[model samples]
Target: MSHLRIVRDEPPKRRERRPHVNHVLTHAEQAQARAALKGLRNAFGSWSALAAAMDVRITTLMAAARGAYNVSAALLVRASRASGLSIGDLLGKPIAADRCRACGQIKRRVA
Candidate 1:
């Protein structure tokens, strides 16, 4: 009996593409994001840690924290949910956790 050997060829390497720059945040939005990041940093210790808790990449967190890039509303929603803060809160609104997210009216505690 005779055995045959087969040879496999390696695939061509792909060229590395530069990272895409999608959007840039406005001054107001940037300030809000930075301030929120500051609050989060106190709790999470670092951007990487906060990103892990937020279920997002470190780069995404960094961009949002630094306001170096525009972030999607979805990301904001995720960050708000993860941080237990409303979107307005993350946006630097002077609302407390006891207040309604939209109207900012304080909710009475139920017995």
Candidate 2:
């Protein structure tokens, strides 16, 4: 009589969670990001051109523009720098009147 051996499959591994990696934007934020992306594309004349200016993949820009995925803070920073738009604008946050437009620092009152 021949002995039979049973084969068992290994359990699937759990994915490691990275903190502060993916940021899920709200509907309003998503709309703001989409609009900012559109403005960047128009300024650059093409998505590929804008992607090149931002130092990111064209597909990343395309996906962000389409709202297919979450937009990262890094991407927004790049967009802000490339398009001269504030990060607050991209995230749909209002710019505070007390904040400086160039540096975003609050103005100090003189005594």
What lDDT does the true structure give each of the candidates?
0.72, 0.77
Task: Supply the TM-score for candidate 2.
Answer: 0.60
What residue pairs are clashing in model 1? none
Clashes of 1: 0
lDDT of 1 by residue, 7-89 (tens): 66986689999997645556687577667765676566787788888888989778766766566667777778888877777
**In model 2, which regions exceed 4 Å deviation?**
1-21, 92-111
lDDT of 2 by residue, 1-110 (tens): 99998866986688998765464667688777777787668667899999998999999899988888777778888998886767886566444545665688987969
**In model 1, which regions exceed 4 Å deviation?**
1-26, 93-111
TM-score of each: 0.55, 0.60
Query: Which predicted model would earn the best lDDT?
Result: 2
Model 2, C-alpha of 90: deviation from truth (Å): 3.1
Worst 10 residues of 2 by lDDT: 92-101
